[model samples]
Target: MPLPDGNNFIEKFAKSFYNLFDTPATIIKEKIVAPNQKTYPWYHQKFRRVPTIDQCYTDDPICVFEADMQYRRDRQVDSEILSILRQRFEDCVLYETPDHMEKCKHLLQQYEEGSTDWFTKYGDLGAYHDVKVAYMKQKHRMVWERRHGPVGSGMKEN
Candidate 1:
């Protein structure tokens, strides 16, 4: 269908003015090709830019915020793994009493190994980040599947 012709002076003038520009198609194409916030890493997504470690530590607010968020998440994962090992070690030590040093030695060693290993699991940030993001995606998928039943299953609600 043809668009309606502008009926008023201002509308006609605006329409004619905008029609003078012939770059809307290219503008739209550029927008479609641009890297959006969703494509960025979760931590620094707001700024749509990658910041170096030096920038993060040197008072760049966006970088600082991203670093802080990452630190907290890393600490949380570390704590979850370490706390379990720590609890087992403490329990073994508690029960062994006089022989705790010798009897609980293995548990102590495991705890230490776990604590150290957590940091070096993937040996690099890129691998660790990929795993962590994959885990989050899986967790969300599981939750959604639980609520709606598996994809392609006939039990989903409308």
Candidate 2:
């Protein structure tokens, strides 16, 4: 649903920024192909030949408002989806979580259809990729421990 009075940016941005930066290594790609927020980060920051952001700031304002609103919605949706994926990744690491936790069919309907479930799991604020990697290492260590039975246990190999 559209914003009650009109679309707003900060409100929408707050709900989506976390998922926007999940891929720390490829922040630009993540922003460009944000799935929902497809507007290039460059688009916002780059100076435009047709009109400057300042020029467009208060011109009509509604159009700008709508555009900004759309941008926020897109980013929020993208971030929410990515966040769900991130959470699943973390869960997989800590709890040996399995794959295909849920299908996308239930996403907009179940997740952001006024649900916007990202708030509950938003903690430390930067654990997506790092948690995923650490989890991988955890599983690796578990496997190694089982095979070697401790590094200094004298389980020598020829």
Candidate 3:
């Protein structure tokens, strides 16, 4: 059958346009797999490698911020005694308005001592490095578990 005068060009153009986005048909083939062969389902993507923790990048702004934040968090946790003493001192000062100078003196002393002890223990580069290392280790584990399933689940590792 002959296409109408203008319909032929329009039909050809429309077909070509549609074909631009259409996926090409693939030929199906049969394959024989041995019993020992391992194959993943079609939906599964390529194998992913286990996550690794990299060293801290001091020059990078994002890395610097993360490292500093981690250090401060760990330091705060380890200095729980200092934080308690400081909070007590603040509470005393806030409660005793007029006699705070004398009434809160003991708390002030305790807070100062706690602060000194904390500084002596965890106020150095060694402490910061320790915190960063521990944080990175934890992040690596969490990322690996999230990407691949839990360890010992028989997941293939690349």
Candidate 4:
């Protein structure tokens, strides 16, 4: 009989191995003594810099309130901009046909080859922006794959 996919074999092996030692490993780990919380690196690095609620009380409470309100407004504006960009990015990817993808790739090549005004040549700003974003995302993926091997090669997860 023909063998199943390679992933199936690996999954089966992993499951069998886990089943064999899962209980014993848990028992051993639980029985071992854990180090003091103060000795842990993250405990000192994270907690030492944070101020408690009582520590935040100040003589000029109005200034603190105003500062907090400004901070919240800035965060809200940032979140709105991020949401817009995400929508644009998704629309660019979702609506791209194979021909459009190829054109975007060619435009990227032209831009890389000293045609700095490639976007202006496209006329429509929305189309130009979408193509540029798609090209950059593709380039990023290519570079990542080159550095770390193909997806699911046991180096990085999906």
Best prediction by TM-score = 3
TM-score per model over all chains: 0.32, 0.25, 0.34, 0.28
- Please list the residue runs of candidate 3 whose C-alpha ends up more than 4 Å from where it truly belongs after superposition: 1-77, 131-158
lDDT of 1 by residue, 43-143 (tens): 54353245433445555677656654655556566878889999999999898899899999999999988876764442334534533343445567678
Runs off by more than 4 Å, candidate 1: 1-52, 55-59, 94-98, 110-158
Q: Give the distance in Å from residue 3's predicted Cα in candidate 3 to where it truly belongs.
A: 98
Model 1 alpha-carbon miss at residue 111, Å: 3.9
Best by lDDT: 1
Per residue, candidate 4 scores C-alpha lDDT tens digits across 1-158 of 76766558778898888879897777666665443223555543332223322334557565455444443444345555555555554455466755556545544443343223332232233532333343345566578778777644646644
Backbone clashes in model 3, listed as residue pairs: none
**Candidate with more favorable, higher lDDT: 1 or 3:** 1
Residue 13, model 3: Cα distance from true site in angstroms:
82
Model 2 agreement with the true structure over 1-158: per-residue lDDT tens digits:
67763258876676568557655647765665565663565545442334322334554666555554443455456676777765655554455434334433343345444333343223233544232333345566567778877644766464
Report the candidate with higher TM-score, 2 versus 4: 4
Model 2 vs. true fold: TM: 0.25
lDDT of 3 by residue, 21-53 (tens): 563421112233344466777864444432222
